[model samples]
Target: MGEEEVSNKQIILKDYVHGFPKESDFLLKTSSTIKLKLPYDSHDAVLVKNLYLSCDPYMLNRMREADASYPTPFTPGSPINGYGVSRVVDSSHTSFSKGDLIWGITGWEEYSLITDTSLLFKIQDADLPLSYYTGLLGMPGMTAYAGFYEVCSPKKGETVFVSAASGAVGQLVGQFAKLMGCYVVGSAGSKDKVDLLINKFGFDAAFNYKEEEDLNAALKRYFPDGIDIYFENVGGKMLDAVLLNMRLRGRIAVCGMISQYNLEEHEGVSNLFCLVIKRIRMEGFVVPDYYHLYPKFLELVLPHIRDGKLTYVEDIAQGLESGPAALVGLFSGRNVGKQVVAVAHE
Candidate 1:
């Protein structure tokens, strides 16, 4: 199939967006003329058939014009790119061979030639659902593990608070904290999500933040002694309240600010001064920095998955055509769990 042509259907960004992204911002186009294998002289490149594509919140930032912080924007006419689970069709790279199952950054198209394999993680166990590479077993898993174990540094019986607690990273963080013997409570967007956090993920308690009038009061009610660790997922108003509720010397790992991503003017966190007075340690982190811990993290997480101690939920949208709606659903809290776009199931 090296030289044979295949129609490549891609999700292309129409233009840079200003506010909340509509499905119309993306166009699904199919091209019959394409290369299905790594091109000649393509040093360290692998051609892959994408199986599952992750629809994450951060992808929204990439759709907008380049910012001072997020400088890399998706090319207007090109296929949008994000984390994906793929099966290698052909390779010029020594590290990867044809038929290898790998997960990393790839084009939103049906087939993608990945030039840089620096971030690619080989899928070893074929028994597990390959789609896990897009969520629990992939980037979001590493994020939850590192942010909770390495960054937060929890102790038994401590109080932990997680915002966006029912979503991918939040659910995993909540479960990890619970396993560490900490009292964990998560905040979700709806009653169903809140219930899933407590019943499914084994969170100590959960609440719908959308129903709360005062976030500060809500935090106070749950964490009477104040939160020892705050897994900051939703920034803006949530951050402001968490800053006020955080106990002295508490740690806040700022993984993302989904609330502020679509805004033209980012909302200010007014309680930042509390960090100084409270001796609280608040730092932002990107997941890629902790990729080195992948093997060890898997060792720690696998047993929990094997036994009944841990569970993960995913909202899968079938096919490349569903990419836009699936990705956009993340912002509005339409997705119940980890949002994954299934291209071709194995």
Candidate 2:
């Protein structure tokens, strides 16, 4: 089929976000035929057919205004952007070819012209599911690996606590901590997710935060001896509760704060004073800084995946039409695992 005959469907941002994003925040539109061939005159660009798009909590932050402290915001009336797996259809860059498979930042559309080819990573192994690049083998995977090993500095036999335990990065963090011989406990919003964390991801113990009236008491029950490492995903009350239960000289890896994301005023972490008394180390991290260790991460994780020692789950929403609902579902704890939008069949 000719490229001119292929139409592209796109999801464009409505405008800067206020409190929380709604389905109306995006508009689905179709574009004319895609250009199969890259213009020879153009430098360092590649055209790709998107296969899968990731729905992550951090993307919500990007929808806000670009403050001096925050990263750049998504442009109004433009295609909403996120990490996706794609097949290169046309290229003018030496690093990638026309048929190469890649994963990186791409617009929420059927086709994308990646102006910065350097951002794309070539897919060398397809033995694993290609859709994994949108989740476990992609951004969330790196986030789990870097935040756990790099920031948390876990030692075998240490007690670990992960909030939002059944979600993308949290699931993997629990598994990685388990494999490291740590006693891992996780907290989820519902019974189903808590069960998945304990039974599927091999967490030593799991709890439904919704069932607990006192989060601090729940944490105390989970880690009677105190937690050596805490993976912070849901912040606010959960974080404050975790602070009260943290062991002396403990480490806390701040991967995300889903609880505080939609709030008009950011919630205060009242127990931060525990850091001083306990001499604990709490650090916030972004995954990209440790991209250099991706190869090393693959070396460690791929074997576990191949041997069935590791398990990854995805809550995939088929078609671009489901994109808005899938993204919104994260806030309500509707998705059971790593929420993804399967935009097309590769």
Candidate 3:
């Protein structure tokens, strides 16, 4: 037959944001249309129907002007893109075909035409929830795995601390530390999240950082002996406090600093001297650098998921229309778990 066409709805970035982001910072465009087939000359292109879009803290960096990063800045009038789970509707790539499920970096729209398929991963083990590919089994999962296991070099019986402990990445890190036989303590912004970290995730102890009058004292109370390993997710004040409480020769895995993302002038940590005095080893890592370990990570995690040894919580926004509000909510600690925007079911 003939080429099919359909109306494409998208969440577009209105402009570069200053300070905290708002729903109005993004525009929902519903008038666009796209062909459901690749161009005749299109080489290795994949046309996909986006099923779910991932709302991650890292996307905030992409909303700004282009930087020296894997994802460049989003164009002012174009669709805002991030990691997503999609079904292949059309493809010219050798490894993909119609009806196959895939997850990767995709546009924030009903449909997307992806030219670079290097980052795209064909979803295997369809028996699990497809939305898991947006967080638990996708980028965030890999991030938690890489940062905790490789960067932290965690040992059994060590005292571990995680900031933003109930977040997409931090929750998994705490569980992994528990699995390693470590004493894991987590810090969250709310009492509800603190309870989730302690009760649901099996963390040894958790505290509401928002309620803590003095963060340094709180860390001391949890880790009286000092922290052997720290999974740093929140930066600024928390990092400074953790620095003071770190054990000698401690290891710190520097993941995303969500606290500094929206600030015009990022908050400075005044505890660098702690690293020197404590002889601490601090390293910052990006997930893509460890993408090669995905297969190995799945080998270790999938069994735990099946056995109900690991738990993942997701906060899903209903539709493409909910994208802006959901994305903006990350900064305010409004989301309970991994934030996902459901664009379509299939």
Query: Candidate 3: global Cα-lDDT?
Result: 0.93
- What are the lDDT scores of the predictions, listed in order? 0.91, 0.89, 0.93
TM-score of each: 0.98, 0.97, 0.98
How far off is residue 288 in model 1, in Å? 0.8
Give per-residue CA lDDT, model 3, range 1-346, as digits (tens): 3187799999999898777889999999999999998899988989999999999998888888765665577788889989999999999999999899999999999999999898899999888899999888999999999999999999999999999999999999999999999999999999899989988999999999989989999999999999999999889999999999999999999998999988988899999999999999999999999999999999999999999999999999999999999999998999999999999985
Checking candidate 3 for backbone clashes, the offending pairs are none
* lDDT score for residue 23 of model 1: 94
Q: For residue 170, what is the lDDT in candidate 3?
A: 92
RMSD of each: 1.1, 1.3, 1.1
Quick one: RMSD of model 2?
1.3
> Top model by lDDT, which number?
3
Best-to-worst TM-score order: 3, 1, 2
Q: Candidate 3, residue 319: CA error in Å? A: 0.5
The weakest ten consecutive residues by lDDT in model 3 span 65-74
lDDT of 1 by residue, 1-346 (tens): 6688889899999999879999999999986346786667888989999999998888888989886576378999889999999999998888899999999999898888888789899998767788988989999999999999999999999999999888889999999998999999999999999989989999999989889999999999999899999999889999999999999999999889998887888898899999998999987888899999999998998888888687999999999999999998899999999999999876
